[model samples]
Target: MTETTMPAAPGAVPHRTLPAGALPHDWRAVDEGWGRRGPDFATLSEPSACREYVALHHALGVDHGDHLLDVACGAGLAVELAALRGATCAGVDASARLVDVARVRSPEADLRVGDMHDLPWPDATFTVVSSFRGVWGTTPGALDEIRRVLVPGGRLGLTVWGHVKASPGAWALAPFRLAAEPQVRNQAAMTSLGRPGVGEAVLEAAGFVDVRRVRIPFAWEFADPATYARALASTGPAFVAIQEVGEPAFLAAAERGATAHVRAGLPLRAEVDVTGFLARTAAAR
Candidate 1:
């Protein structure tokens, strides 16, 4: 499909210029998913999310003095960590409800509801700009905004979603089909962690240099069905999906069965493939 160019609307929000022709369709699915349990989603993501952000800092050899920005920060966890490292941390997200919850849950960071394509800040405002699970379906100009926001010599860090087939954490969802509209289900199948390159040519086209990405595999472990269900509820998308199939009883039972192969105290492992990338936003020589 041919992509279109979309600029910022108005005010402080950034404009997204995506190549996808059908973005207007089913945008609400993601919004509702995050809104239903933004807090739970944020908390559930806290564990691995922390390790991922810390690795970004170390991988880039970034110092505490640098200013950092997290694009599409769901609950401010990454923003919070950036602040801990002594950088001026800020987060921007499109979900108002999520941003509100983030403000209440994480008081240390400054967050706003905005688009990723056209950021509100001035050009070259940050030393490090990272995104977690937000760059999917990036428009043509979105990468340009990322480059425009970072100072020369700054680094852009991002994490892309891995394919569900490769990600064990998402294994259960493989068999569990959703009854949502056909479009939503189709989107589920079409999007993969590797979909956006979260670390590849986008940066190259956006004028960034030295782009690199690494594949990191991790697991989500649940001792049994009960614990797994609780953890599963934290994901807005998964919660709705499970609800659509049936109630908690059915979901719990499904979890129990999926986890049957594992012994007690040894959590059922769900594999996730995470690609972490770092690129330098440098002035063209």
Candidate 2:
């Protein structure tokens, strides 16, 4: 499958790099949210996402020496997994605290704190790029930046929460959305690529080829409704909801949403449907 390539612009586009200590002004909110949830993400989210990366590695034909980049790589767990499979790894994330955890987890890795839209890398920097629930609602500029940093024919993989209709916990987002202020922008980002063909269209527009999607079985389990609510409240959108409606109200709504998924007095288990996309850039640049 042929794909259009973004011609290298050399001096025309000055490669932008951030100071190792520099971070975007708006990143504070994200940093705070993820920082608070860093341990949970490391214990819960990252493991769930990384469990599905084996297929992605196979599809991309990752090799021992391949340079891999995990965009929006929270806690660097995925990069650590890739390193286990023999790939050299680097990662970028918006949360300084999460990056700190990642640094400790993969001390040899080149982990950086930065926005996905303005990655701190030069052109053709990686052989494979992966983003787990990171690319949604990101601007076209971010997509361009992803393509720019990939070598010709480099593989790209992204995972988004699959369409809620396909999940048993279909009402998962109801409480959050219902409580979220109407003025909250990009509130739909959590499920932006959830619909059929939505993620593929976005990837193709960014010059990706051979785009394919697969649904992976994932579930979030919490010992009780309160724990479930707290976990849910840690998400980025939940942060927005907390800001709009306050944390107490937000967690109340989350608990209301969580009760529906509780089972057998064991735990509240919410089935998550994850849709992953794998595609490649054009080989002949």
Candidate 3:
């Protein structure tokens, strides 16, 4: 497939150009933190993102004709789901362990352990691309790479945490506060794309057009507070907390945070606000 390029729209947000051989963030640390409990994340944490995956795929109109690539695909749940819908699916992630699980789950998928900022695929390879809360404000460079791998007018869909503190399930994220102040601050920066106008501006800057935002469903359900703690500990953010205060302390904090949300017989549910962005590569000129 031939790659296409379009002039930036007038008055669009200016894109930041990085110096040669520079990376936007520490992908190695990200890989280690996320891959620490790869199996646990696949079984426990990845399921919680099913709603976001389904919603975004639907929004992007993923179907049989599409060749899809899922960035930061974690354990490949999204890739597996897209394949079920008849799309030819591929995925890439920073974590080798998670990529292993993903490969097992979607044996037919072309899954790779690599950096999102520099995808291994050729230009104009995919018809649709997605990243569920994987691409963040700090990683705008990944959007450029995503565009590079997408065919002209190819669709892109991504999700990010939205107004988390205002969500009904805000307690679900309380355990992350156990991390050191520096990590907490970095977490805040990562989620900044979820803020109003932030993601759209960044997408536009990356030369994507028709950018729009939609609210997507995101919830975490656990059998009990202990289960909640275990699930929380499997994620990357929780790893930071676990490092600052040992895993035992972080687990205790998570359980305590979830205690209030427990019900008599129902699963403990934390339904947090998640924002989804849908955009398209500039059409052939």
The prediction achieving the highest lDDT against the true structure is: 3
Q: Write the per-residue lDDT of candidate 3 for residues 1-285, one digit (tens) a residue.
A: 000011111221212343422223445565567777888888887788888889988899899989999988988999999998899999987677788899999999998766676777889999999998888877788888899999999999999889999999989988887888877877788889999899999999999999999999999888899988987887888877888899989998888888887889899999999999999998888
User: How would you encode candidate 1's per-residue C-alpha lDDT over 1-285 as one tens digit per residue?
Assistant: 000111123232313443321122233344555656666566553454555667776776656788887887767777777776778777876566677766775676667666666676788888888876566543436677888888888888776656666564665544234435653554453344256654476667778788887664445555566656555555554545555666565466556657655666676666666677778877646
Ranking by lDDT: 3, 2, 1
Query: Candidate 2, 157: how far from true, in Å?
Result: 0.4
lDDT of each: 0.61, 0.70, 0.82
User: For model 2, what is the error of residue 77's alpha carbon versus the real structure, in angstroms, after optimal superposition?
Assistant: 1.6
Residue-level lDDT for 187 in candidate 1 = 44
Q: Give the lDDT of residue 187 in candidate 3.
A: 79
Clashes (backbone N, CA, C under 3 Å), per candidate, total: 13, 0, 0
Which scores better on lDDT, 1 or 2?
2
Roughly what TM-score does model 2 have, to 2 decimal places? 0.84
- Listing every candidate in turn, what is its Cα RMSD in Å to the true structure after a full C-alpha superposition? 6.3, 5.8, 7.0
Candidate 3 achieves a global lDDT of: 0.82
Best by TM-score: 3
Model 1 lowest lDDT segment of ten:
1-10
- Please state the error at residue 59 of candidate 1 in Å: 1.3
